[model samples]
Target: MIGRGSRRFGLGVLVGVLLGFAFALVGASPAAAHATLASTDPPQNQVLASAPDQITLTFTEAVRPVPARIKVIGPDRSVVNGGSPTSNGTKLVIPLGRDAGKGTYLVTFRVISADSHPIGGSFVFHVGAPSIDPPQEGEAAVTKADPAVVWALGAVRYLGYVGLVLLIGPMLFLARLWPARLSRRVPAKLVATGLGLLAFSTVAEMYLQGPYTAGTGLFGADADAIMNALGGSYGTTHTVRLGVLAAIAVLLRPFVRPQGPSTIDLAVVSFFAVVGLGTWPLSGHAGVSPAPAVSLVADAAHLASMGVWLGGLVVLVAVLLPKANARELGAILPVWSNWAMMSVIVLSLTGVAQAIIEVASFGPLFDTRYGRLVLAKVALLALVLVVAYFSRRLVLAPARKALVGAGGPADDDEELDEPPVKPLRRSILAELAITGVVLAVAAALVQTPPARSAADAPPEPYSVTLSTDLYRVRMELDPARTGGNSMHLYAYNPNGEPQTVVEWTVTATPADGSIDALDIPLLPVTADHAVAEPTFPTAGDWDIKITLRLSDIDQATVTQRVRIGD
Candidate 1:
């Protein structure tokens, strides 16, 4: 009844809304891109005659700096800055070497971002003239999952996939043995349930994927950020997954049997189960390893096992209970027990593999938020296993006796009990609840980096001492930073006389290979120690190598920096 133009307008509005939601989901996380240098004043592929007065490197967003560092290679790969890096806001300044040569020089730098992400980059620039240079150790950003988050997401994603697979896979397998009992229409309905869930999850995941990949929610990212994610490998994998899932839906007819099981039924169930497993590799975890296929396989096993366990339970409650007579249920229960046990064993093995791959140590289990959640999930899983064990050992094992009204005359049957069924049903409900919580935790963990890796992390804290005739100078940098600009440095003297510092020369460079120096001022806060405000240019570990001159023979050099900046 609507006009063509009006229909078109409504369609257009729907399309726009879909696109907007899609963008918002992907646009949420600023942390998704992983901090890296966007461009520099000197430029990576560029050459210049004279060194720029200052160097500035831009990134996708604001980043925190660890000691803010930069190193001039001097065409000889030797450190040209007097001692170590210093900072000046977003610009990293390295002091020019007095006797520097005239060839192309490589700049390398590292820093930490405000978001606690590590950022590093490098560029090549010539001093005398502009000329092409082979790409220097090209700038790159490093990312690692927080251990707790890795295991958290890993556990949840697999559990959800397993539930779906178990829910549908067996209908194909079971239909062949008991045609009437399996029913003509249940397979279709089961497949439909999976398809519906998969569809909803895919849509939801796409929205959350942006935040998951971006490392923040919808409020944190911009249009360019979303566009960038779409243009990367992350986007490519998701597209392939969508295609695979769509194919599964089209080929789903085999899974929903009309009466008997066919080769098509068997093949489709396996294919869809494998499709469910596909999520792990497509997740941020897959690209992390050198062997992508191996990681994918491990993840697949984890998902397949989960599908058999959780999905089977769902099917038992929603459809199987009402349809099956006590005799049929007695037969089905034992077979399900075997399948559930096999799944539990496989799940345990794969879960360990995944945990080892993602979590380096057990400390995070208690220390990190993600780890704590993972522990909670494990406790819940244990409870599920206990329920399963009791259900199998105490209730279902005595199958002939548990049934109320068998058609055949039974001479050796024992007295039956129905109260155990109540407990079994309750346990299943609890299992489903646990699985749901696991999924939510997974959503959060996908954004965090592992806590163990050294790439973007600061070195563990230790002590350094620089001694002179008048005093012994000692400074301590925490090595592991807890939060915002909490860097502490201590100075002391052995002599009773207060040491007066006439001048302090401070120069810093960014890890991204950015700059030279700014004319900085220094004021004395104490007779022996002077307080100087340093503006770090980038994020990551910064090498703070400083020399303190008390007198001609009374000078000391101290170098220290923990993780700093964003």
Candidate 2:
């Protein structure tokens, strides 16, 4: 018999192992996928020609222009630019002030893009004279990944998926094995446990997903603030997940009741329940599963399988393992094991498939924050599986040895061979505990970018090429950032120099072809770039009309319509 001291030492060892496991997760927790300014417009490590007209810094994603400021450092490291940087969208620009003296200028800025992401970056450029013509600029919006949040929150997302699956996966497996009208209705305790886990993870996820998307806080009250942020891809997906979750909440009533379930009924219930739960990856980093559609489907399958496997173990220990009768367990363990093993295999394969899709290249795997966190997660998974393998091999097979003397039907060979396993039950419980930790880690991984980065979506590059006449004009929109009002115009006279014009008139009219020719002030943004800064006061479709007078008699006008969403 195990003595008290022996038990204490063993318990200490178990606690130490769990603590160590948690520490490993913590060590990896700080690592993140958040992309910061890798480099900037004027660039870091390089001497500049006389000062450039405007400044721009590049980051991992689309950035907004709110805290965007250019800190023009003096020889004493004092700021020069008037205040903050002016953001147009993809680039941040500062108007050159009076007689800008000679010296290196440090332009620092912070911005919140339309995506609700916050980014801070800086660059250095020199100005020779006061300045040349103003440069048309866009907002510096880079949608960087928050690695820490991704890792931490991802665990919640995936854990929620696991809870739903485990919460329901077994009933389906049992239905497949046992005939309809016979599978025991899931117990209230089991349903409560699953729902409890789901709720906990969801609360954690809400906190994580909100700020993580916008690069906000990890533990602050910002989660509530991020409600509107759900309008995006990640938000949209989680929204649907909520709907599926609601269904589960309602269905729990029927599921928890004590009644036998039919195979068809169980399958239908399990599939939809999981569908309501597992579809999260679809709108998240894993949605663009590397295997494409098949990979995506497989990911869902894998999630469902994991839910069944892990959640089932929880059920077994809580509901079946504690029972004094070995007979009931003997009859069910093997069948459950078979299904559990199958689910494990499926989950592993699908996870790999999704990983392949997310980590497009080897560089992102190590060089990117997302990649490193993913690798850490993979390590944790390997550890959990190691524990699982031990339970399956050493603890389980021998526990069945006790069944040798038990009297049972010969036809029950499978169940008959397995006496009520008791000692091995501890191993099952251990495995389930470790599995919970794994799910926590997985939750964080889900919130992270599948691939080290989303460069895979590679925005569709497009530009408007215009061939206007005598003084040929070509307007090309920069591909670095898309949407919003963006275009570059190059005009050359027959001699190919600056087109000295007697009159330059540009205007905007309603797209309705309204003869009113919308009366609006034409703001001169750049020598070559001009804009109609009309108060878009309201959100709607608006038209921009450009009228250029080369000499007064030689004027050309082009009208373009733009659509804005609220």
Candidate 3:
């Protein structure tokens, strides 16, 4: 029999898996920013009569060229991209070396999107004809991002959001609704944590941008890479944000005092805050958006309102409501309620505007990943708003009583009752929890590709790895639908060395018995690799058999099943 704790653990795992499956079904896909390859010279899998002298790539949006991120491998497994790429207005031109002779060539490219995010892809083309042996899978070396690095980046972003809520909400409360009885320690620690998070995230982002854009591993950053990152527009904006945070640090003393920031200090800091906040939009999707000026301004307003409203909620629930007496509650709640009402209004209007610009069309709202995330955010926000409505009603009860003359003056401490306190606290807590989910959705929105761009792209390809006793084979099927598909197969020995194949045979059989097995003609591009174009006639599971003959006496056959879509 399982212990209680073990049952709970198993249930939790099951629930998590169910949630993950649900998200996957709803297309909570991996992030890819707006910049997409519009067209490439010798398009994907194009069979050219002769080798081209240069490769030209045109993107839907202009991207900052990182030549090191682009690799062109010739049939002989040698790098043939001449040198640095020359770029001009959404187009990148990479000259090819004379050695890029006949046979299949693979082009691997990665570039920084206009929003400072990295996007990458790989495609193959043939010159004269497919080679007898091409580059193997292991030799391609297109590394997936390190999981640790991905989590680190996400953590930093989450911390930044948390910090903003802590700093902005409490500061507003301290300035407007803070009572004398509340201890300063709680809010002070919160403010300090927020500032520290902002500062640290900025620095961490600067460091990570190099490795992220270079398509390298976590510790792949070097002096040149870091400097190059710092030199870019993205880096410059982050640097400015850091400076603003430092200034805020120096002014913390004035900010924390009972007598808040003086007129000049307030103005100076407000200006810095605006400039610093603007940097976020400058380096994000908003900056690259159509009608960027409008989008940027709207996004900034949206962020500011989120800080004011959410932060205020945090302060109310955590500090004021708990410690304050009836008198203090009466005095603080009304003013905070009014502030929150206005902030919510601003947030709604601005959020709608930004959504319009990003979503661009109604179809994508449910069809694209970004739009799905936006819908989730709106749903959560609506829940918070409902809770806020009840909290506001509770806050107004005292004032309503005073207006009807059942109580004495509204300011009288003795006449106040604590009846609504518990209910109001619970409502605020519920609102806060829902808003936390909204923040997560918002963070996901920033990382996801915009709906307008994602909706226009073609379906991504399918890849699989299969193995036999002697070797492992990696295969990629481009556009694995009921049509013509390009298949690339790479075979490697047990020791990770490329294994030569004297003979190659492949067959595909439908799993449902609706169709018989058919032999696929695979042309050997190299001793370790082969290429084939086969038309899948229907949508179903296909059992793929790859038989490789290493020598006259040695051969092995591996079979794997793959799904084909309509």
Candidate 4:
């Protein structure tokens, strides 16, 4: 009867989750990806008539500027920014020095997105004419956090997850299922240890955020960065989490005692648990998602369900099975099985909801890092469920058969023969081991950009300067992918002055000779400037040959190779 009911419940849960996912898909719209450059004043690679007083950058989302990281470098390789960059929602305005020169200028910026991820990139614009050699910052164009800090943050997140499982499981079992004759010492110690680990991990994460966002080493966070971290939404949620933990600690004092918790104490602790779980989502991708309310509730429920189910398994394998006698096991196993089943149902439902909101489409699910991790997590969870099923069968089948043989149902005082313990323990242990790996994957998922954002992210612009005996040609390609690309060409004399051109001819051919050379038509805007829209049919290396005619007698051709990506 128990097995049949569990199957029915599982089926209903699966149907409900599928229905919810379908509805989410129907209502879903394209959400803004990570913070990306949407547009810029004095547009990249363009030759402006004059230098503007300021440059404005529009991003896909609101961002907080990183100090000392946003600057404009003039043609003379000197800082030309007049003042600090100011942000108005998604737009950032950088004041340019009044004396900015008449050559290439590089604008580099680094900022933190609303979701706590750092984004950095650079672009170039020309004043009057292109520079003979543009100012370069090398790898500093795209700022990156230190490897040690990244690894440490991931480890701390995983530690927090482990603590949740350990703490939630034992405390729950002690309150409801623990036998009166058994000592509470071991379970109480487990609860204390879990609490300590959680507290430590939370404090560590708060400190790590400063360095992580600053693109610095683990110990490189300065006073300003630390203070900024504390002032942001990430810091606010974590601070609330610490407060919630403190309240839980005080309320739990009576809960883990031998006498168990009073009804009022249980209600208060439950309230704190919901608030605590909420902090995890409010500080992550969910807080900035398209459906923030739905994402928050789903994420919180997912955490709670994971904590209860995995934590319960730990308590069952380590403490209950080893110590409880036949009659005690008969009474405890059935109730625990029911709770585990319910927790799994909630976990599955919330996991599906989050995937729908974050991944959005099938293409991203199969193409992006975030989506692939989700697949790996699902595979691991399925394996754990298989082991859980076997474990449940072992417990229920024996307990039911023994009850039938003993007449109808055994009373609380009646003794029943113990079921096989060794096999059950092995199955539970296997479940816990797989769950640990799943937790690690979850920690990684939190750090990765969502599939929707990764898939929608724009490709980097490609630019190159080629030289011939007669002249230098700089070609700029916007989003060099397998599609129509806007191309701009600027001609300069060997002495770094604008060179007049009478005619321009351009053609592109695949490096492997897969296709014949295709002529690209160019329209001249000035004697030294021309623009065209060229289409690359496929993704691979292509050779572009440009023939310029200074006069009938002074023509030169330059060939440059460019790579196009899918």
Candidate 5:
């Protein structure tokens, strides 16, 4: 027959799952955490009277200046940028010569974000007229990062997280709750392994940063490039973390013993541990967060709590539980349970704080990728907690009862009935598995753009090529907004050749007759195309009239209706 504890555990799981679903249903969308280009002086696809002497790009956050990462190719497939690029404040400036002829100039840029992620994009602008063919020779510069680099970087991050799990939790277990009889050798090796992984990941990240930002192959990042990367915020934090790890390696020996370190030694190591934890947030999204100080502290707390809880589980399953006698486990489990409870509380609180700061509002929690990952983490954590509750209630509680009733008939009978050790081992192993997935999601979360920052990010591109019998006229409304919108028109003959537009005119009127027709100024881009910037005052269905004269003798007008939203 099932015990009272078993029934309670099952009920708790059911309730937690229901609550998780309810929360997901009511939650707003999830958001991806990524830095974006806020604006550009010569906006994408803009037409200019003459080539500007420089191109300036403004991002939502500060970024590292990697000269080789920014390339400007003119209509002739020749580099037009005159000097080294400059990164100042939130702007990246690329100088160009005034002689950058009348045609399209494609600017491709790659920069390391404030959070140490590599972001790259390309934009094109026309001077005097559109080029017959824009430079496409070095198209490699505009593509995504090398797949090997992507995999290697992700693997390194995963390794570092695993190392953190091994390093932090086992140390605490040894210092406080470990059984005296258990050998310290295994636990000590685990700590050393964790430290090694973290140190190796940090060094690898520095080397990878150069190739990542430059959009090059893995081996492409050299010593000079890596050194230049170190000069940036991401590199500095990594270097500091390496130093902390070195100190930790030296001081952690005493603490790995069953008797543990002296109070002074413990104090010193703790201080460095906290400092090292700070480096993670300082080099990541938290450092540039809206409330940087608060977010950084919360992130550090979150990391520390995760290490204690998840890492503790690892030690309990792999070493402590297996080696300890029932009496030792009865003693160790309760203390470990209390520690886990405390870690959970800290994790929950700090997680909520970081989420609030990063998510900004309820809407993004359901709407964005970051939010979805967060929800997954929350759901999995809830499941882990449910299992933990059962483990404590059925396994630890019964074991404690047996310990109290030792040498009595009731103790022997109860121990035989439950066999709590096997169940407890299984529960802890399950919890570790779930938390491992949670850590993976956490890694992804750090890479994403915060919901708050992405909430007001630029809209998706809106452009569609249209065709007609008299002449194929392509009308594009940039950003598809209600207010000011940039529009471009390209005309072609029935034979699919560029057709000269002698005269072009456009009129926009509300389809519902709420507003009168307004003229839009059309500027000639080439023999076959013209551009215009029009303002739609309100949100509604609007009709656009495009009249183009392919020749003095032949002209055609086409009307297209489109809906605009606020």
Candidate 6:
């Protein structure tokens, strides 16, 4: 017959699988978490009468360009960039050759965001008209990281978290609550295994960083990409973590023995633990957060508390519960309970602070993918806490009575009754099972872009096609707000071929009539294309009248109502 504990464990596993499936569904589609291209001069797919003096790119956030990966291919399939590109905060400028003749120009670029993630993409613009076949590069414009590498990186990170739990839990138990009668070999081996895993994960992460950033396969990172990866903050932190692990290994040899860690050894280990933990946040989103100091400290504390709580449970369930007697349990359970409570409090507080900083507002908490994952984490955490409450009650009530009545009363009849140990073990197992899913959610959260950045992203430009008796006019207004807006106008015949426009004129009049009609000047770039910069004085609906003269005698005017916002 299946036991109740077995059924509960099965149910927990089922719930975890369901939650993981839900998260996978939400996060399956890949999206860029690094800086996104906001606007480009001589915008993509635009056709100019002549090549511009320079090509400028603006990103949502500041980025460092990979000089070797930034290239401009001219119509003649020759590199046309005049010199090295210049970066000024969020803008990158590439000077063009003076004598450049272009049909279509391809600009491919790769840049590193401030948070150490990489972003790459390509865009095309024409001089007179688009090429029959636009210039294409081999792999310079590959913006998506290899799927295998991405999955491998995520798996390595998960293993690293598991290693942290294993190392921390056994080390703490051996130092404080370990029974004198039980052999230390098993727990010692666990510590060693955890340490080895951490070392391996650190090295694997370093090697994978190059390919992850370069959007290449596992073995595709070039020497230059690898060198650049090492020079960045991500590589530096991983290197530091490896060093700390080495030092901890040396310091831990004596600590795991029967003699236990001395006061000085404990202090040094604690300091190194803190430094090692700090590296995690310093190399991730927290390092580049709006409030870096608070985020760094909170993220570190959150990780530490998680390690303590989860690791302690592992030790209690694996070694202590099975080996220790009733008397040993009575003495150990209360202390572990206190420690677990404290860790839970710390975890909850730091998690809330991180959510506030990363999500910023309630809208994003439900709207963004990052926010949805945060919600999933919270739900799983709540489930763990509920299970923990039952576990705590079972431990404190019976264990405290057992400790108080030790050696005073011989209650053979009461001892024959059900022991709390079995139920407590079941509860702990459920908590661990659920928390495993929580950890997976946390790992996915690290890969996702924060909700605040997604919320702050600018909306797409407004575009409309207006038709008249003679020609169809397509107008695009970038950032159609109560400010300066870049307007591009293209004229086409009824059959959709480019229509030659002899002259073009534009005017804007607000529906509210709060201001007089404003004349907008248009710079004709080609026979069928014109560009203009118009400033809206206030926020309201405005009617833009476009006059296009197809021939000297044949002319038509079209008016389109555009809503402009502040």
Among these predictions, the greatest lDDT belongs to 4
Model 3 / residue 42 / CA error / Å: 2.4
Q: What is the C-alpha lDDT profile of model 3 across 1-566, one tens digit per residue? A: 12345335544644454354344435533333358888889787676878788999899888766666677898888888877888787898888876567777988877777887777777777776555455644466665556666666767777778778887887767665676655677887778888998888888878877776766677887877667655657888998999988988787786677666677877787888798789878978888887689988988888888888888888877776566655566566667766776687677767766776777666677888988998898778777877776676665555433222212223554454446666777888998888888887887677677887777666667766677887777677888889899898877787656778888899999999787888899998878879999899999899998888888988999888889977
**Residues forming the 10-long window of minimal summed lDDT in candidate 1:** 134-143
Per-candidate Cα lDDT values, in order, are 0.51, 0.51, 0.75, 0.83, 0.77, 0.79
Give the winner by lDDT: 1 or 4.
4
Clashing pairs in 6: none
Q: State the local distance difference test value for candidate 2.
A: 0.51
Residue 29 miss distance in model 3 (angstroms): 22
Q: Give the per-residue lDDT digits (tens) of candidate 4, residues 1-566.
A: 14777777786777777677667756766566867778889787877888889999898888888766787888888888899888888998999876567998899888878887777778898888888778886523446778898889899999999988878888888778888877788888888778787888889998998888887788988978877666668888888888987887777778656788888887888888888889899888898888899999999999988988999888877777677665666688788878888899989988998898898876677889998998899889888988888877676666533332222233556554644667778888999999999999999998888888888887778888889999999888888999899998889999878899999999999999998999999999899999999999999999999999999799999999999988
Give TM per candidate. Answer: 0.55, 0.54, 0.74, 0.92, 0.81, 0.76
Q: Pairing residues by index, what is the TM-score of model 3?
A: 0.74
C-alpha root-mean-square deviation, candidate 4: 3.6
Q: Which segments of model 2 are wrong by more than 4 Å? A: 1-121, 129-162, 169-186, 213-228, 262-271, 288-295, 324-327, 360-380, 393-420, 447-451, 454-566
> All predictions: root-mean-square deviation over Cα?
17.6, 19.0, 9.8, 3.6, 5.9, 8.9
**Cα deviation in Å at residue 482, candidate 4?**
3.3
lDDT of 5 at 339: 77
Model number with the top TM-score: 4
Per-residue CA lDDT of model 1 for 252-340, tens digit only, reads 66545454547766676567657655754555554453335665787777667776677677766655555565666666766776676
Give candidate 4's error at residue 201 in angstroms. Answer: 1.5
